[model samples]
Target chain A: MKILVCIKQVPDLESRFKIAASGTWYAAEDLAWRLNEYDEYAVEEAVRLREASGEGELVVLSLGPERAGEAIRKALAMGADRGVHLLDPLSHDKDPRQIAGAIAEYARGEKFDVIFTGLQSQDRGSAQVGLLLAGLLALPAVTTIVAFSHEAGLVTVRRELEGGARAVVKVRLPALFTCQLGLNTPRYPTLPNIMKAKKKEVRTIAVTDLPQVAALVRTEKLAFPDKRGAGVVLEGATSEVADRLIAILKEKTTVLK
Target chain B: MKVLLVGEYRDGKILPSTYETVAFARKLGAAAALFLVADPSDLPRFAGKLYLAAAQQCGEYNPEGHLALLLQAVQAEEPDFIVFLHSAYGWDLAPRLALALDLPQISEVVALAEGAFVVPACNGKLRRTLRPLGQRAVLTLQSGAFNADGEPAGTPQVAPLTWAGSAVVELVGYEAASRGAVDLSRAEIIVSAGRGIGKPENLALIEGLATVLGGEVGASRPVVDAGWAPHERQVGSTGQTVAPKLYIACGISGAVQHLAGMKKSGFVVAINTDGDAPIGEVADVLVVADLKQFVPLLTGKLGGV
Candidate 1:
């Protein structure tokens, strides 16, 4: 089976975010950007499935500006055979529906037996695109998939449901699933493959050249949070600790109300 | 411009988050409107319009679908600003909508100012200011972000949204790898374990206390990644964001992402061998001890279920 894994480039979760003085957006002046933390599970799952079957190819896809090539290259080094980078100047600003639109249009013209993506992007974190993409493709869609199985052209997956419930369902080939973390510990790109990824090909396309997207229904101003007044720490022992803390807690959340 | 609180409903029923979103949205405006989108339902009773869409379930009390519909309505009937609670479906739906709409979106918004939205970023330690370049913005509100106006700020008015196709792709089936625990968010008191529990078998001790507390058991990424626990139980950036009234973390060093999800939790008590562990940094109370000995003693004292 051929596999296509979707990934996104985002600001590193550890770095501070700042809106530009102009107020257009977070100042990207010096912030670090990398593959979304969750997409790694998507890329990793594709690789693992390929390794387990030992007779398949993994093609990774991303939609973004020039630096997105770096993200795609990382996927290639992680064991994907090659990459396709959809170049959109505002890829960083594109909505999940629009982004999913581009991916679905491209997939319609490609040859992949299955598709995968992180359950959600760390930054944009809208986990909808994966399921929406499946809907567009008219394939079985599963959300928060932590386990999977593929055999004899049929696919089975488990979706995390509310209140500790789950729904295990199986669909045939050509399905889209959002991979949650712990589905696999994605491997970092190896040194040898890291060098090879530079030489390998990455297909880039213009966003305008792709399918047309509806007018963005909304716009956003990205901002970081204000600091919490220095946190209050309670000094105490183990047993009475719960009792004291419970008092403070009851004083805090609306859960008690 | 007035603040708009977006909500998801099916068959004319509103979820609790809708009320929560409305209550929160009212904070940013002198008066606010709570809007619901679905197949023309009983929205007149709510504070705003009832936008209709193709027949389907909006949310499972956690509606990514309803959020999509709400975004569509937000587009059709633009608001000065929109607010949503950052639950699982909200987290999955809101950010990209903000991105698609090119609107400035702040997720995990814990505080709001006239020109600035105070959000927890880089996890919880760092907070930054967001000034919307546009006329409006969308925010995924974190629990306990603000004190919602106690008094109703807006009168009820019905706004109608006609049916239409969703721009978002559809998800056919939501099958899980395994059945995990239900709504980890609603658990009022949470007993969470980390990789420090040593082994899956060790979870029995944690479960013992969880039973006593009448709460659910949550885990850190390591344990979930190790397959000792389901992904649903994992509480952190990659896992669920829980704002339980009382959070008891055992044998876990707090990573930024892990703290991002739970730090808003009302009161946190941490137990770890290293008294200076990162999780201990913000904990309301620190119990420095080996969980191995502590768990048995704690459970013995609390007694069995």
Candidate 2:
């Protein structure tokens, strides 16, 4: 069995973000960057899939600037057989669907039983990639998958839905699953794997080689957002505070009951 | 030109939100039709043809599988545009469908206009008009993006068809939830407390504000992890999906996870002492003063008291 995992390099979750002077996005300078937290789950799931079956190869893929290779290395360290980096320096403002196209184009030539991605990226939170990639690949797409297993060309997965609901589904081969965090605790890189990943073949490819640019949407500009102030807390008991808060909310708008 | 609208139903009943989508579809074109991918008897009414899928539950709605179905469906109808509610099912499938069909897709659009649609882009920094590349475009309308168009449109003719036996997916089991549940998607207002509020006991103060707003209270992941709020009340990737009219984030640092759930509110007000907090960046109206000092002052000035 062959598996492919999509990963992203994002700012560490704990970074302090301040919007640029323009009201579009945050300033990236001097901020610490790292692997997307949820994507870590994707890499872990792929690794586990290979280990459980004991015969599959997991190739990890990441797209971003040159710095993105740092993220692919982490997945390689975690034991993926190989890594691919698609260069895109102007990813910040491009359409996510366009990026999805680039990924689909590269993987179109290869055959993989399954593809995995995080449910959503930590930075954008658009939650569109895995599904969009599935569409582009003309394959099945599953979101918020918390668990998975393989049996006779069929894939079984557990999906988390709204209101604490859960569903177990069985899908055929060549499917897409977007992972939720906490689905599995990712393993740390072992000393042997760490050293071995350094020798693993790391492939570098350009965006132009893929079929993504022709369909890509151009971005004009990305600005930072507006600023906000602090809030006030009401004094007294819950009842009094509830009453007082309700009154204040009512005064501001007509939503009051 | 006619538009194709997808109607969703579950457990032999139509969703209240699907009707809103139907209404939105009707105004978009004269020959609009909703492909009711379930039992026809379960729905309220439709203004156009209700095309039923062979299986009962839209065959578990895998984006690629559904796109395959949609590609065939669109070829038959020749719809000028396709629209749907941006539900979990839609989110997973819509953009993929757009890419599959090689048509640009726009999401989180509260309103539609001629050729181009008005959508909130990049955390609501600005609302931009998005135009698709093809003549026939696909779109996922924001949940509750528009109010109901009108009464049950004239009973649409139900057109049922057999499934192609190619969905390649099966729903093994589902854990049903209780009714009268707090669905954040339809909530009109929400009050959320974050790390700045301190302590679970302080939630009462936050709940006070929720009671006034006639809405539910929410919390950031840290607050929920800290047991200050139930996991159900948490907003973000791991929590509920809420698009209330007015959303107040009290003392929250505004992580992306938290924003994912509620950033689409009609009006967002953030109360944080830190001028550089992430919440402050996207909030339409911001109060930079201390949450503790101002929360009561605003509550005290309320007239209903």
Per-candidate count of clashing residue pairs (backbone under 3 Å) = 32, 24
- Could you tell me which 10 consecutive residues in candidate 1 chain A have the lowest summed lDDT? A220-229
lDDT of 1 by residue, B112-180 (tens): 656666654333434444555557777777654554455433445555444333323333444333335
lDDT at residue A161 of model 2 (Cα atoms): 63
| Interface DockQ of candidate 2 | 0.28
lDDT by residue (B1-305, candidate 2, tens digit) is: 78787666544556666776766765675477776556645655775676666445455544434566676677778887777776666666677667766776666556665766765543343344556665777777766556685667567676655544554667777765323355667778888898888777778877887776577888887686566777778787557778888898888877645776787777677777765566766576566656676666555544254
**Cα lDDT tens digits for candidate 1, A1-257:** 78899998887654546666645345666879899877988998899888887887788999888888889989999999889988997765555568878888988777678899987776555456786676567665556776788888777666554333344556667767788766768897889999998888788878889878764333334443322325554443466654554455557654432
lDDT of 2: 0.71
Error of 2 at B210 (Å): 10
The TM-scores of chain A alone, one per candidate, are: 0.83, 0.83
Query: Clash number for model 1?
Result: 32
Q: Whole-model Cα lDDT per candidate? A: 0.67, 0.71
Pick the DockQ winner: 2
Residue B52's lDDT in candidate 2: 63
